[model samples]
Target: MQNQVRQLLVSLQKQLSVTLQSNRETLCHPVAKGDATEDEWLCLLKNHLPNRYQADRAFVIDSEGKLSEQIDIVIYDRQYTPLLYNQNNQIFVPAESVYAILEVKQELDLDKIQYAGKKISSVRNLKRTSAKIVDVGKSVAPRPVTAILGGILTSDSLWNPPFGESFQKAINSLTLSQRVDLGIALLKGSFDVSYTEKNEVQTKIEVGETALLYFFFNLLWRLQRLGTVPAIDYAEYLKVIDELS
Candidate 1:
């Protein structure tokens, strides 16, 4: 079953590449081209991933009512998090519900990586409040919030080895809050970073035709490890600011 699923994903990836190639040559509007590419990946993920975790293009808002820059894709827990804003095609999700954010691009490069970092920081820096979920009907006190993951999804790479020198340089330049946990350059390879017990960051690079399969399954494992975003603490959203007469 796993082999069959991976084979289908590989075939779909080939189609995604073809779509990107066609858009690169025919789509004059850069933004449209980028959106189309993102939408394709988003759809693929939606179809393959579990329905409990919803993936969509939405802005993340925190308890302080701060909004992150529009992320290309947001994987959120809809079961526990309230869909804050949804009107006229625009949507906003609570930060406490966001598990991960992905920035999709046509090609992988230094500039794109830096841009993804900035976008990630916007969401990472926000204040998220969590409540302990005792069960479906019962609840307890708030708990420590989990870190939100971030990454990049690209159709191709610009560097020689794709995930080589320039890629490492860009990743190293980012601060802890701006770190991108994983990335996939479909035409080349995938890169992942993790932290050690001593707080040192460890990075791994996998370059092969099965990069997408590796990336996808790793993501599934991460989702399992994360469990679920804790219950959102609505009290944090109730600001008690006094108004002057």
Candidate 2:
């Protein structure tokens, strides 16, 4: 079964490659941007990463309720509960349920380390709260959370930059489990997926599946970018998925 699945992946990859090559000219065209804000970029990364990772779901919450809530991404289970907050809040949540929290900073500042630590503390608080709630209510279930910090730096230099340092700090600070399990899809100039081995696998999958899923996710990402869909071919993509299945 593993071999069959791997074979299917390879075959799909070849088909996708051919499709991308045939449509190279069109694909090369600029991916139209919306407002070019950090949030928009984070949203794009979130949507794309999940599809690439075959994740059940991915989401972004701007910490609307809390002062320290600047979480950029929160990956959840298929049920859509919070696994992790990118930034921490005073509210207690489960640490095990949280996959990871990604804090995106555009620049590498020394102060951001302190900022990251503060977020972790808030996350710990949420865990405590979640535990208390669970203890009070027999119906309540426990969940875990993880946290990570990501910095996006764009520069022409090929070597010696704050980008590398910022990334190192984020990775170093995270628990080993979080470092291994978290997804931080950072985009500066083009999209960079070299943060970890898992990210590398995800990038390859995206490239491999581009032909089959391009139009599907292109429309999705574009809609996310535009914040609306002017036109779509929903049935057509569904037909493709059906055929593929």
Candidate-wise lDDT, in order:
0.85, 0.34
Per-residue lDDT of candidate 1, residues 169-201 (tens digit)? 888888888889998998898888887777576
lDDT of 2 by residue, 84-174 (tens): 3333332322232333344433333445544544554443344211221234556444332223222222111132442365545554564
Point out where model 2 deviates above 4 Å.
1-36, 51-68, 78-97, 128-160, 163-245
Q: Give the least accurate 10-residue stretch of model 1, judged by summed lDDT.
A: 236-245
The top-ranked prediction according to TM-score is: 1
What are the C-alpha RMSDs, in order, of all predicted structures? 2.5, 16.2
At residue 199, candidate 2 shows an lDDT of 41
| Candidate 1's TM-score | 0.91
TM-score against native, each model: 0.91, 0.33
